[model samples]
Target: MTQAENERRGNVPPSNKRYFYRTYGLTIASQLELPELPKAEATSQPDVVVLTPGVAEKLEGATFRKGWLEMGDDRCQITIEGVARYRVEDGQRILLDRRVPREVDPVADPGDIRLFLLGSALGGLLHQRHWLPLHVSALKTPSGVWAFTGHSGAGKSTIGAWLHYTQNWPLVTDDVAVIKPHEDIPYLHPGPPRVKLWKDALAALGIQTEGLVRDLTREDKYHLMLNKGFQDHPSPLKALVMLERAEEGEAASLERIRGVEAFKSVMATLYRPEMGTEFNTAEQLMRESIKLAGKIRVYRFRRPWSLDQMNSSIEPLLHEIKQ
Candidate 1:
């Protein structure tokens, strides 16, 4: 490792406890501590490192916009309005600058900014590292790991929660699924042990709201801790389910997706599409997409918006996965 990497691996001038954590197939070291994630094993080496609190006020080449600006194909600069600014570099290093707002609550914890970093910034990092991050929730079942992908409000998290709480399928990830493609099979990495749920979705499933942490980013949304926790090891991906909301009277059903259509549909679910653009990963993404589509079973899963239909779709979905 280089001197810079050595500094990142706990040789930097210190202020707080440097915490080690694992996620998305990498062991990470971060100074901005988070209590929500499990600590990494002592003997494991870090793949990425996050430096905190002193990231540059503005990146030299950045063209600041509403929230972020593209810094060429290898880097990007993003700000969280009044919270923080981040400079993500080459998929390996992240620099964060935390800010305090004048109107902020005196007791409000500013750590949420770090959470945003882990999500958006990390997504960018994965792209730079040649990993394909998808906007999907995943879980392990007897059949293997199944990925649920869709546009926002298509019930990815709700279904993941349902699979976890009701069907007893252990949660693998929520929101972003980072995949490492092998010869013909891509492996799914476990993410942070948190599930975000809308108030109505939680209520529909009879899950209690008490003591849950509110997601400040989205109104009336709560972050839930999984009872069974996350799978630390990677699991081979078995299937992809593209979720779509059907008309009120339309019954839930699953249909196979094949050939070029499957590739296009799957590509649309990339966690942050522009991240790929930044890395000039289109060619690589195309190759990976075709391989993934050809290897895994892809299905278009349509269901009503109503939660009652969820249970009815579960068994059929499992059966489809088995096939």
Candidate 2:
């Protein structure tokens, strides 16, 4: 898409008529034509439709719990009801006149709000190693596409934020990268083009907070939008790094981990949960991801998240990989 075209269609806001909430991946589409988006906080339902290019994945054993809301993006609609979130496949016309949310205290603070939504998220961040979706964080540098992998709090956002801060690199995608494997050179579907890091971490990265969006999740958690006032670019992936955290001095160095061990690392960093995306999707994603790993170098990176450890341990690894 041309810059002029993207400039014409700015970001849409949330609507009171509808809400959007989900854990599945989506493909931003072009056929969507909406009059206007509702002006409200980033709540559950938005009256307007979002455009995505990726295919909508369904969830298994989904149930409508209290405090859940349904969010739709053209090809996908996620009803985040109760503890289990459901991915509704058919995107037929929604009856907005019948739209009714259970109830939520809009004036509540982040922590209290989080309490209300926990059942909706249903311990999303606590999934087992084999269940999480294999999400990718990547950038489009002049040299090649750089992709990073990790579980929640595995520091994918932290590291991706740091790279964007210090180096001024253009990001390809973050949080999710829909893969189309086996094309000789594996490529990631153009994703959200940004990853929101914690504000304190952003400050520590030495990048001034210019136009970042502050998304407050419940409790002590907050995410900062990195694409604030930035542009998007499409690029092919070059290197894939699977991350794992350890004690300050645990990892002696970033070694070339290979064979099943390498595949295991890739599996460990997935982002989607088990209920929404099944084992078959996991196997397919892994097959494509492993192919990418086979073509390019896949490194298992272990590092402490502290400032000292980040620089002393992980910095060297980045330097080594870039070479």
Candidate 3:
């Protein structure tokens, strides 16, 4: 192991599980601590074992297993009858897990860690949906894949809810959305399709969902999974909206943008980058992720927003693309 890595693994107790923390994508939030996943024995030394701070209490009699995550989701349980054995594998690689891989960074935080996890998973099972540099939420509308980008308090939920209920569109992602750009073609992958709306918005839409709203940091926001209607829709992206509330009477204008200006705007909504982030390289990436006319555009919307206004505003843009 490198000296830097050893230093990071420092103070990790062999007998404790204190919420292992790491950051991915953007930056760590100044003050947000989350729980760590439980531990399970491995039959073989992991090819890339990440020694996170873990709770010391062993599950009554948990036994080690091979080619699996430590005591995977509840279904992966075994009685601890014997010692678990594992040997590290050769030709394995461990990544530092950067959100913007080639970009520069100072440190990693919990949010960044989450981004890293998603990025790592992108290669294995989620490869088909790997496109663009994205946040957690990506909504699916009847027209195409819709992504809302902005900093916290920018009213993404408000805009998203208005789009769905007022306009009758479906949610793709509430917190995160990945945009996968095709290598040989001009297309982005469809990451997660769902969104979280504020409680008032849910009520306004008259959705009868029952669950623990406590998980939400925003009392107004409720997580939503896209309906089956989006299951077979086109996977390529449609638009990237930077949602922000304006004073009453402010005109909601849709503008086309490119480059670094675009990157910074998109970075704001991402869950990772708790520490916050900025980009010097944005134009090409931003353009590549969404179709110039049909897929991507920026809208400075005003209050009294509704589905009708959204559709009316967006229809012209969509028609432009069709032509």
Candidate 4:
């Protein structure tokens, strides 16, 4: 019988295994094991639950549609053409619907499902919960947690990896940096323990890509889990450094930004900013951004982008952080 038929007839056998994971300050109870996230003790009532694959359901009265995503107030439906369909509801549950048959696709190779689950689905859930998710890589230092943010290919991951591998800073999070809303100080929550790097970035760090899990969407990129330098707890926000590529032969520079520009910079780093609009969360996000701008320091760091100058470019930022 086909997968859909089995679901229709209620013939799908329930798996006995259960997994618990912690990420973005939330405890998750899932039917599938997520190797990217650090394991947590099982909880009777987790903050989120990821259900096993079953029948797909249509979302009613979706207010926004963009590409493969449909978003409403408390629910989101994401359809990846050939892979799977995911529904995130009320900031608490995730329902998976695999497009491919089970016989054709084994459970062992769940990279595609994991990719969207951790990326788009989780982002939507964060929106539902009213947390600020920034597109940045972050690390915890003695002072506090510092984050790097910029446009894609702007060296956020590269700098973050360099600092972790060479400087021995514990990695707090990668890709999506979750900030809990607060009245006084902004706190960053730890995310999945893995970092995604391109082949060239790995080579620049003198690390081999063998045995690394390839990113399902990008063949040249791979996910590397930090076994030793992973921080799994929330930390107070320190500073946010915005990276910009400098002209050839130009020296690296770091300058502190304040007031309106700082607020705009933080707003620009939002993960899936359109979700704020669709969920009618723009005003709250703006208020939080303003609070974040007032509480933390923001800096613009301009440096050369070549791999050869990676160390020289990063040193000044480290020195500035120490000051």
- Candidate order by lDDT, decreasing, is 4, 1, 2, 3
Give lDDT for model 3: 0.39
Per-residue lDDT tens digits for candidate 4, residues 1-323, read 66534542335754657799989989999976788788889889999999766635456688877788888868889887656678999889988776544444433246767888888889888888888888889988666788999998888888899888887889988788688785255888867777888899999999999999898778998988786788888888889999999998999999999999999999999898887666546788888888888899899999997888888887888897777
Quote the lDDT for 102 in model 1: 28
What value does the lDDT take at residue 237 in candidate 4?
A: 83
TM-scores for candidates 1 onward, in order: 0.88, 0.60, 0.46, 0.91
Where is model 3 more than 4 Å wrong at Cα? 1-133, 136-143, 166-170, 181-193, 232-234, 267-271, 274-299, 302-323
Q: Candidate 1 on 53-112: residue-level lDDT in tens? A: 566556676543334655654777776655566788988888876542325542224456
Candidates in order have lDDT scores of: 0.76, 0.46, 0.39, 0.82
Worst 10 residues of 1 by lDDT: 99-108
Q: Is candidate 1 or candidate 2 better by TM-score?
A: 1
Off by over 4 Å in 2: 1-77, 81-87, 90-98, 105-134, 141-143, 206-218, 226-233, 250-252, 273-286
Candidate with better lDDT, 3 vs 4: 4
Compose the digit string of candidate 2's lDDT tens values, residues 52-108: 223123423333222333232222223432211222233322211111132553122
Judge candidate 1 at residue 300 and give its lDDT.
91
Best by lDDT: 4
In terms of lDDT, the poorest run of 10 residues in model 2 is 92-101
For model 4, give the 10-residue run with minimal summed lDDT.
Answer: 100-109
Candidate 4: list runs displaced more than 4 Å.
1-11, 55-58, 100-108
